[model samples]
Target: MPQETNIPNKSILTPFNVVAGIIILAGLVITVLRFTKGLGAVTNLDDNNPWGIWIGFDLLCGVALAAGGYVTSAACYIFGLKRYHSAVRPAILTAFLGYALVVLALHYDVGRPWRLPYPIFLSPGTTSLLYEVGLCVFLYLAVLFIEYSPAALEWLGLKKVRNLIVRMTLVLTIFGVVLSTLHQSSLGALFMIAPSKLHPLWYSNYLPVYFFISSIFAGLSMVIFEGTLAHRFLHHKMDATHLRESEGVALGFSKAASFVMMGYLSVKLIGISVDNNWHLLFTGWGLWFLLELIGFVALPAFLYSLAVRERNLRWARWAAALSVLGVVLNRLNISVVAFNWYLPSAQRYVPSWMEIGTSIFIVTLGVVIYRFITTRMPIFYEHPDFRHDI
Candidate 1:
């Protein structure tokens, strides 16, 4: 005799599903409006302020937050931090999704999305920093894909392919680190040409150095942040190793981030002193800058230090969140808030509702995709078949 069992299907009408559906639908509408009516139809971008939150939030914040991939991989593969091995897959997945979304958001910002490949393939702008960013982003996105492919291959039961890709892990990590360094700094260098337009307090010759250094801690903080979220919602998806090592990863990253943030603060001070911008700090812009540095940067650094000293995971999580916000604030200050500072208030750029909605839509898409892949793939846990190999 044999018995048959039937399982009930999960409902698709849950709250998250409903909200995500609405966002996706709205995003489709905005996409149509953007392509049909042009950038003016969906954004507040103008000749004076061609860059808006799309560039500030989508590109700058996206890339900076995605630093977790290189940071985590470098720690594990290059720096030989074996305890962090459990974190590599999740970090790579986040970075891959983040960069993929950055490229997608660019389509909404650029006048000709199709021409994005033109600079890389057809006509390389060797003299332009933008071209360097484009090429690195393109290549680095490919590297992230390859770096993240092992999880997918494992899920598909492709052992040979996954192991082959695993063999190249060290080489890919090094190449990715180099590309990330170049583009992250190049992003800040792009604004150096507009020294007069950017506020005196924010502009400097060391802008590139500031950007690169901050990205290191930004990536570290993001790893902790992502781990916290994953622990909360995706707990069941993680295996014993991930759960066991998660705290260690958080604590170690917190210590590293704390030291790096202190270094970043010191360099920022040196930049001001070198540029002789001390007098500007007493003004309104200076106060705002101080808020960014002190409230966001210094406070988080201190919190991280305390977290590491006390071994408090909760404090580490909070510090990571604040540090992530600091990176976002710094990028927006440079690209949006501080750019065109001398312009009249009326002429300044303010994002339209549609622009904000589009950014939300893109982020929601990433969240949805991440949830889908992590649920199905070997991102949060080691596959039983390959446990010994890993």
Candidate 2:
């Protein structure tokens, strides 16, 4: 028999929803202008600054933040931490939607998005770092969906299909981990070739290591943040048991985030020492770098440690927010603020209204989709019929 669950009665016209709808509509209009008028018409981009917020915040940070999917999956499936099983579905959904948004934003950023598939099928730029990132992202997105499909199948009461999906979970999770590891590091590798362009404070030969390591904490922090929201707003979608287990999950995330944040800090310091650029610490740019390292990374890491020790979920959530902010700052520093560091201030690129609008559109779309799916599907709670099977 199919599982019986209580679906929440949510109105589609809340204030937040209305604002999201308006932003989405504006973004649609802006997108139309962008396509018809060419990149020059709606963007502040030029030859000196080809990439802006779309590449930095949308594609780069989006991919990094989505790391929760693989982290949660590996924890439950690979490491045999079944206690975390309840979080797996929501994490996977968040990751799948995040990657989808990254791809959608890329469509608006690229000169000709129709050529997106060229690397996969036609041109196959085997020698390019971007090629590796592209292929991994594309394949990983598919893997995320496959991993997440069991929930959808179960929601629809398709027992046979859901069982088939459940059987494939282990294999799919393995693939997700492998693919995520490659592309997460490869994104940093994309900037390695332009060491001269990136600021000394942020540039390093070990950038790939830095990016991959930081993503660990970043993803975990997001899980804590998102999980908190789920417990608050989507409470009706979750079972009492899931609601109870979520507290432990938040504490676990804090513990893991603290350790990873320490390692990331050490690695970041080592990267600076290796480059023999400690002298740059005296510069203005270096001060900003210090603020990022100390204010966001080190401070939040300490908070996570304290929170976990005290078992204070509230403090942990605050730390998680700061940790997420740290990752966003790091990506933006690398891709935009400190990119082309040697160039004059006037030459630095800033996103125009259209670019910002498009980015917001992508985010709002993700939120709407997440809200829709979690409300309708078996995301927050398992289907009773297959709970034992999963």
In TM-score terms, which candidate is top? 1
Pairs that clash in candidate 2: none
How does model 1 fare in lDDT? Answer: 0.95
Clash pairs detected, candidate 1: none
Give each prediction's root-mean-square deviation over alpha carbons: 2.7, 4.3
| Number of colliding residue pairs in each model | 0, 0
Q: How close is candidate 2 to the true structure, as a TM-score?
A: 0.96
Q: Candidates' TM-scores?
A: 0.97, 0.96
Mark the 10 consecutive residues where model 2 has the least summed lDDT.
1-10
In candidate 1, which residue ranges exceed 4 Å CA deviation?
A: 1-10
lDDT of 1 by residue, 1-390 (tens): 122222222366778888999999999999999999999989999999999999999999999999999999999999999999999999999999999999999998999999999999899989999999999999999999999999999999998999999999999999999999999999999999888899989999999999999999999999999999999999999999999999999999999999999999999999999999999999999999999999989999999999999999999999999999999999999999999999999999999999999999999999999999999999889999999575
> What is the lDDT of every predicted structure here?
0.95, 0.91
- Tens digit per residue, CA lDDT, model 2, 27-109: 99998998999889988888988888889999999999999999999999999988888899999999999999999999988
User: Which runs of model 2 end up more than 4 angstroms from their true locations?
Assistant: 1-10
